[model samples]
Target: MQLSTAVERFLTAVQLEYGYSEHTLRAYQRDLAWFIDFAEETGARELADCDIELMRGWLWQRQQQGLAATTLARNVATLKSFGTWLERSRLVPGNPASRLRAPKAPRDLPRVLADEQMRRLLARVEGRGDAEHPESLRDHAVLELLYAAALRVSELCSLPITGLDAGARTVRVLGKGGKERVVPFGGPAARAIDTYLTVARPALIARAAQAASAASQSAASQSAGPQSARHDALFVGNRGGKLTPNAVYRLVARELEDEPGGGPRGPHTFRHTAATHLLNGGADLRVVQEMLGHSSLASTQVYTHVSTERLAQSYRQAHPRA
Candidate 1:
């Protein structure tokens, strides 16, 4: 079958069956599109005409184009998925790409903020910002929850009001691959969210509705349906819409712009910092994995390396013996 046609079918199936997110779907589609273009360059009529050797050539071409190991690995993975799908549909006799492989990418230790740095950073945020504006309150709550729960930016933004369990101090998060996990937060996050929900959110919604009222009566009539549906969104924009991940990035960037001792100034920096701090405080690896919603312990194990590196650095600096 045509490789491009097969790619479309596979993407649609994954979208419908596995519920892949738009971000994930776009990545896979892009990888497959690259493969089809490469296959055409090699004069293959369709995916059925391509074999393991051609797959290796495609990977080699990507490497020659200066693609990183991670990109090469992703391309190999894309081909494997396509090959498996082709086999299942009887377009190919067996999964040819099961034999495919790529170079392992060099893994960098996650950048963790020092305990003192985190304390100072959060304290600065607390003292510097105005509490009256809804956007300001939302940013505060979002940052607190991001650090408290080690949340991905997408997961943080998708959170709903019902996700918070105030009594238990836990937030039920829907993570990647549509997996749901309950993660606990601290008192600071709880208080920040309480202020945003009770004071800021209602005010923001009212402000949006009032503005819409003056603009168009038709907009006002239809507003109730959408507002009712989105009422559960934990964080909202100034215009009373679901807060997006990009807005979260800008909030974090603006807050971190003047902060000291930074490796990365993005939201994931908080995630890395939180995970490393948990491990430093002797949180169990398995427990941290569950809290972070990582599918594998290996993914969670990266923090242990970060923890050990810090320990080694401290020992070297403090010990008197040469």
Candidate 2:
């Protein structure tokens, strides 16, 4: 079988059978595509041409090009899965990448906001411009729910209108691998969402309808009917479409541009801050794991490290004796 053909089949099988998320599927596709191009360059176009040596050389070349350890680790994982599938399907003699090993990437602690910084940030957002403005209300709700639920940006953007329970102060999130979890938030988030739903959402929808009508009128030859369908998303963009992850990223980056942080200034920073704050307030590790929709306890343990670091910093500053 051709190498490219084998990769397509493997990707399809993973998507259909394993239900891998789009992000994971895209990563797998990119890594395999690069590998296939490299193999073709070396005159290895057939699936049978792939071997342990070829795989190792590809990784080595990427390493020489200065790819980050985490990226290389993902590349190795992608190859291993592809090779395993090829072997099982009788396209190759054996799994060429079975013995492949990923480099140990450094586990850098996630950046988190201080309590005072968080307070100031929230206050600033709440006080920005007119509170009655639809955009202002929506932005406030977006930030409140992001921090309150410790949600991933993708999760936040894809949330449906029916996914939230304001009375229960909980949200149903469809996490990675299609797993669903219910996360609870505080009263502040509840109030913000309630206000957005009651006031801002309807106004935004009206704005969207007006925009769509004007577009249809200008392009009357294209269609005489409604230009777009009503979106059921919990959050909508300025044009009334469902909110996108990139939109959320821009909003977060703008908000955090002036904040003191050495790492990324994205929506994940709010998630890290929320998790660390929960740990600092004596929340249980397992409870937090469930809240954050982390499949493993180890993923949740990092917040404990953040909490400990904060405590050590306090002790260093307040201790009387050296």
Candidate 3:
């Protein structure tokens, strides 16, 4: 069988049988597509021609090109899975990438804001939010919920209004791999979300409707086909469409631009901050794992490391002994 044909079949099987998420599917497709091209260029177009040395050469070529270790590791993992699938489906006699090893990607500690920094950030957002400015109100709620729930940006953007139990102060978040978990927030987040829903969301919806009506009446408007279907998403963009991850990234980056952080300034920083804060406040590791919707406890152990580092830093700053 052609290597490319086997890859397509493997992808289809994973998508349908394993229920891989869109992001994971895309990563697999990208990594495998590159491998297929490299294999063909090296005169290995058939599934039987692919071998461990060829796979190693592919990874070596990528390393020479200065790809990050994490990216190269993912490429190795993609090939391993593809090779295993090919062998299992009888397309190849054996798994060529069975012994392939991914490079040891450095596990950098996630960036987390200090307690004072978080307080100031929330206060600034709260000050900007008022009934007169709906977007500000939305922003306030967004920041509060992000910190309180430690939600991924995708989880937050895809959150449906019905998913929120305001009275219970709990949100039903659809996390990665379509796993659903209910995470609770504090009174401040509850109130901010409530205020946004009551004042901001309705106003934004009305504005969107008005804009659609106006655009329909204008002959030069290129977007005169039909108004977007009403969505139940908790968050909407300025244009009243479902809020995108890019918009959330911009919101978080702009807010954290001046804060004391060395790594990424994206919304996951809030997640790391929230996790570290929870661990700092003596929350159980298992509980934090459940709240963060991590399938493995190992994934949650990183926060413990962050908490320990923070403790040592504070001790160094405050202790009197040399």
What's each prediction's TM-score?
Answer: 0.92, 0.94, 0.93
Model 3: per-residue Cα lDDT over 38-125, one tens digit each: 9999999987788999899999999999999999999988988888888888877888899999999999998989999999999998
62 in model 2: Cα distance from truth in Å?
0.4
lDDT (Cα, tens digit) per residue for candidate 1, span 1-322: 6767877898888789877777788888898788888888878767677789888988888899998998898888778877887789887889989899778999988777888877777777666546567767767788889999999999988898899898899999999899999999999999888888888788878877766656565755665433422567888877777888998888888767767665667899899999999998989999999999999999999999998888888889999982
Cα misplacement distance, residue 227 of candidate 3 (Å): 5.6
Ordering by TM-score = 2, 3, 1
Give the backbone clash total of model 2.
0
Per lDDT, the best of the predicted structures is 3
The lowest-lDDT stretch of 10 consecutive residues in candidate 3 is: 220-229
Question: Candidate 2 at 120: error in angstroms?
Answer: 1.3
Q: Rank the candidates by lDDT, best first.
A: 3, 2, 1
Clash count of each predicted structure: 0, 0, 0
Model 1 ranges off by over 4 Å: 129-131, 217-231
Q: Pick the candidate with the highest TM-score.
A: 2
Which pairs of residues clash in candidate 3, taking residues 3 or more apart in a chain or in different chains? Answer: none
Q: In angstroms, what RMSD does candidate 2 have relative to the true structure?
A: 2.2
Candidates 1 and 2: which is better by lDDT? 2
